[model samples]
Target chain A: MQDVHTIGKYADFAVGDIRTFAEACGVTLSVTLLSLLIGTVIGIIFGLIRCSKNKLIRFLPLIIMEPLRNSPLVVQLFLVYYGLPVMAGILLKDYTAAIITLSLNTAAFFGVLVHNSILAIPVSQWEAGYALGHGKFSTFINVIARQALRLLIPQAITLYIGQLQCSSIVSLISLRDITRVGQLLSVRTMRPFAVWGIVFGLYYLVSFPLARLADYLAKRIDYTY
Target chain B: MAMIEVKNVTKQFGDLTVLDNFSVDFDHSGVTVLIGPSGTGKSTLLRCINGLEKIDEGDILVDGLSVNNKKNLKQIRKTCGMVFQQTVIFPHMNVLDNLTMSPIKLLRMSKAEAEDKARYYLDKVGLASKEKSRHNELSGGEQQRIAIARALMMSPEALLLDEITSALDPEMTREVLNILVNLAKEGVCMLCVTHEMSFAKEVASRILFMEGGKLVCDVSKDDFFGSVREENERINKFLSFIGE
Candidate 1:
């Protein structure tokens, strides 16, 4: 075993390494934010399709969602990063592939969530809208959407946190995110504990605020209908 | 002309028939109260008239617009405003928004015009002060009043109220019924299904007794209360049970 003094010397990490980790974290955050935006839009559009009464429209979502949900997300990432260029002849940048895979995978989960939330609303709410001479589209957007949002927000936040953490997987495709930076620095510095601890701390710092925001929303919107 | 006409309507929930070839017509001038026990298709009849529940057979016309025709749905729904038993106000909106939504969205009324109309109905329902109150923040009675006001915002040709006061205390029930009574006096065609016997007696021009998805008796207020017809033993028993 190495002496404590030698280990302590390695623990005296350079400030440049910290700066590199910070930059990597910024990349992780930006990718996660962009992925979330993409996932949310895809989720809403596909979720409406899944909830549709039209047989053809409804089946379209099921076709995409079922396979995406059943298969492993990492396998999906690999296919997008490695197999897509060979299969479809469309070359994608490494970051583009990572973002697309993560967004699509998260969207499948969100699609299911939104579909179930729409179903959970009572039939009477729709009836009330119709009885008042509102069209189906107006009723859905004005009435059902508001009620569904109250239930959707908390569950969406929880899924978003999970997705945020899962975004670390993008590092496997050489996306140069915080996890990848940590892996590189740990190997170079030969101090896995010190390097990984800072990485975990950064993740915790970002995630704790989001979790608290979720709690605040849950409490603030609490009202019995 | 009749405000509402149900022509041999048949409504079924799969194998379970709720309304079995029932037919009725209401004149465009007075309050018509439907009295019946629970699950007797009274609510179903109201819902069917407003196009909320589809009829398996026959047709319903609201203000001479056929409810069976998909193209006429918007016009038909516009003619009849319905207040449900449970307070079905949108929980996320304030009273003004709840009242103004249908008028602004459906009638294409401007925001200022809709708010003006909403305030009028709110005042009519004795809830002028509750225009900014959240649906869930108000008491059950207050919520029901807001619902009534919301329906009135459409300036409907007829109103269908399904035991709207059943969930309220007596004071609130009287408060809501008073608004209905005033609307009745103004000659708003109304089809109300309520257990408030005194209020029914006071406002109803015609009383229709329903049992087993059929109208057992369609009698004038004087005839229904003044004469004891031996043929209506079930209705008499029901009325007496409710202390009517």
Candidate 2:
């Protein structure tokens, strides 16, 4: 039929522009990786602060996390990308804006994950460490943290995949990520279906391997005790 | 100085006073068993001596270091190795690592030296072959024995055991108690909170009975198992209740 021929022709057009898509995929990956690294560091610092015994110190993380978590990522992107230049007279490049917004967003969620993971361990473990003459800091790093890693691995993978998929939103800031590249190609060829399908496949290509790595790690640390 | 001195200590959990004006002194080396009805503050006394629980009044001294001072806590804890009823071996580590980690990190012992001591204690507890086993891989009795070895690796002056055999089956209890008996004969200073009357009779040099946060009787084991039971109706009733 004519529809089948039209689909084949659009698919050929999409395949011909694979190099540009590949470059954009590279951009997406780099941005996600950078943000993930920075976000994890920020998240752990805030999570430890959140677990503080003092009331004032424990409240610190919530000041940043509440707004970032409650607001949509798109709004956050717009606020940083568009609002900063006008209000503060400080302009950021599109990539900088994307990375800042994405990292803060990831930090907000990952902070809570770290807090819950640390809390999931029993107080008895801390006591055992202390009974053996370890101080509070030593107990946390040597005893509590190792056990918490088991609780963290599965949830951290889910978060990583989420951040990866969420990075597609960077295209709205004109960062030329894979989604942006897909947008331009679909507009030019008038082939939304074929172009979007390829984008979906590319995202899957990155995510599947990460999921497998998580599986391997989870099994390695898993034990009945 | 006594190995451990509890000088008129009081401890409270919210409104409920667990230990009130309780005092005792442990000599440098002997087995002293604390026996009483449940919730009579025997375990609280052990915890206070180890600096696990803070006392509301008075103080505890371990190896002449006051538990009241923050600076003394680390040294005090190092001198008093505590084993809990729940068998808290670090699950993330194998038995050898669990035994060796504290000595290497805290005492700054070389790994070779720490491992050497760990093997000696592991052999003493009859768990020499379990060095490579994970905590979860061991049975309840084996885990408790490993816990004892872990405590011994630090070369503590005294061991504080709080209801250690309370959670085990009779067979497992026998296994752990056998190790404790051996440790007793070896002249390890031990302050044990337990309900195993026969085990207490066999190993206890002194017996301290408590009730309602007060020391009811402190007697030598023979006197406690003999005359004190006949003299104190409350102690006699408690002994009968526990099927002793």
Query: Best-fitting candidate, measured by TM-score?
Result: 2
lDDT of 2 by residue, B1-244 (tens): 7888889999999999999998988998899999999999998898898888989999888878899998898888889999998889888889999999999999999999999999999999998999999976899999999988999888888899999999999999999999999999999999999999999999999999999999999999999989999999999999999999
Clashing residue pairs, backbone N/CA/C < 3 A, model 2: none
TM-score of every model versus the real structure: 0.93, 0.95
DockQ of each: 0.73, 0.68
Task: Give a tens-digit lDDT track for model 1, residues A55-152.
Answer: 88899988888898999888999999899999999888978998899899889999988998888788889989988988899899999998888878
After superposing candidate 2, which stretches have Cα over 4 Å from the reference? Answer: A1-16, A219-225
Candidate 1 off by > 4 Å: A1-12, A85-92, B228-231
Of candidate 1 chain A, the 10-residue stretch with the lowest lDDT total is: A216-225
After aligning candidate 2 to the native by TM-score, how far in Å is the CA of B227 from where it should be? 0.8
Q: Is the docking of candidate 2 incorrect, acceptable, medium or high quality?
A: medium
Model 2 earns a TM-score of: 0.95
